[model samples]
Target: MFSRLIRAALLAATPLSVSAAPVPANDAQRGLAALQAMDARVAAVGERLAVRGAPLCGDRQMRSGLLVHGLAQYAPAARADAAALFGLGDAPAVLAVVPGSGADRAGLQAGDAIIAVEGDDVATATAPQGAARFDAVQRVEDRIEAGLADGALSLTIRRDGRERAVRVTGDEGCASRFQMIPATRLNASAGPYVSVTSAIVEFVASDDELALVLAHELSHNILKHGARLDRQGTSRGLLRAFGKNPGRIRATEDEADRMALYLMARAGYDIAVAPAFWDRFGRRTGFGMFSDRTHSGRRDRMALAVREIALIRAQQARGEAPTPDFAGR
Candidate 1:
């Protein structure tokens, strides 16, 4: 009797695994159908708005390349990669570099277009598909992995349409998983690291907007919001475990916004555009519209971001040395 009682208690104490029961096909289908419906609605709205040349909120799309360029050490090469991957190779651009990684230490800057890699002509390569860019990057990585024990590689880059060659030495101590992400979604905290999502770069906008986005994300890393989140997790315990407490989540976002504003201003970007970008997509409304999971309500978050930008501008005007744009420097 006692053994049976103990078994019951143990069972009661065990948490239910989310995967224990597989999601039903019907449920999955319903979710997909809902998404398709939303997509159709958005498309209709877009069609109507296209006539006006801009949506009600202006353009909801955030230009992310500017942010990536501001954060990257080798801006030219990164821009080339982004352009190549996004089928904009003919356009001048740069891609993002992982923070504290080899690229960061080698003085590689964002906004630098990679004209060549290790003397190989990169400009001739075909535009990359979603995974092709990764494959191309891996090929270079494989070369390093194969025999470049010296941890050095040569890169030919173009900055503001001027070509130059620079040598980058790898650092194993640097974290490998860090990514350059846009500032718009710079709120998600993933343990010791913060998560950033990129915006699709549109042809109509200048790259400066993209740089601002990157600057904002880099600020989040500089401020060390991830560590704070971890501490909050420990303190809150079960509340966090059950997702009942949103305090830490909200705090991290607020801190990131504040930090991003400082970083953008310091990077020599126009602060006015930061608010302008949000103003374009700040207020989006429609029922059965895009699910809340993919995007935050732009207006509410933009308001917070604007406040932070104002404070940062005030600080900069006071002559406080601006924060460095690069991470791990």
Candidate 2:
């Protein structure tokens, strides 16, 4: 009986392995060499695009203490696409509050469940379109700006099952500019920009998931992987510059995977979710390059992401400090 119970417990704890063949050693080496060359060429291009002495945190002059970093506010219905992907049910409630923004000062939390906005029943409102979400919020703001409301907009919320009314003042901060671009192929050396042939930002599972993706991309920028690859050698640079390279792209992707894991954790997103996101993405997209110019097929990319997540879990088990907030005030 004891043995049977132990076996069951172990089986329950095991993560299922993805069935896919690893890239061949020779192929891997060639890919790595190609990646190095691409990195050098990309670095040259990035250097030209790099804005000198740009402050990490731009001027914070919003009435709301919130700083938008690569993100934009939308109505609850506009976020339906993401909500469906996350399995948050048909109509999940969403609320936005920047750390130092008016919403924060007015006492709003990230996960706050909003019941009503300015006496309108949010739950029953029409499902918002992509652009309509921002439009709705702007309408509320316009009312305030035109001196229609007293001082604060009335918001009814259900937190921990209890109903409460809160007043929120409108203020602004840096607009969040994060977006996901889909492309048949992209130059890894492009620096901080991921190209998508066709994609939509609203497809992400959650705001946290969106943040995780952006954080990972930002990690590449912070680590200077492009510059590091440039130091690797010459032939690699030539291929990457002309965008005919495949190997170097794979190497840069691997580095970005590792870096993204670190960045997401630090950004306070559930680190485990990152792997799950990639796994789903792989299933939908298939294993291999999107096109010949793309490197690191789906199988390899998914596997590497899983490995990184495991490393993060191990670090957490050792009682490491949580990732600090990289989004500055």
Write the residue-wise lDDT of candidate 2 on 106-196 in tens digits: 7754334555667766543323444423333334333333331344567676655677888766433221221222223321222323221
Please give, for residues 37-103, the per-residue lDDT of candidate 1 as tens digits. 2222222222222222111111122111111111111133343332322223532223333334355
> Residue 189 of model 2: what lDDT?
23
- Taken over the whole model, the C-alpha lDDT of each candidate is 0.37, 0.39
Cα lDDT for residue 124, candidate 2: 33
TM for every model, in the order presented, reads: 0.40, 0.40
Which portions of model 2 miss their true places by more than 4 Å? 1-198, 230-244, 283-289, 322-329
- Model 1 local distance difference test score: 0.37
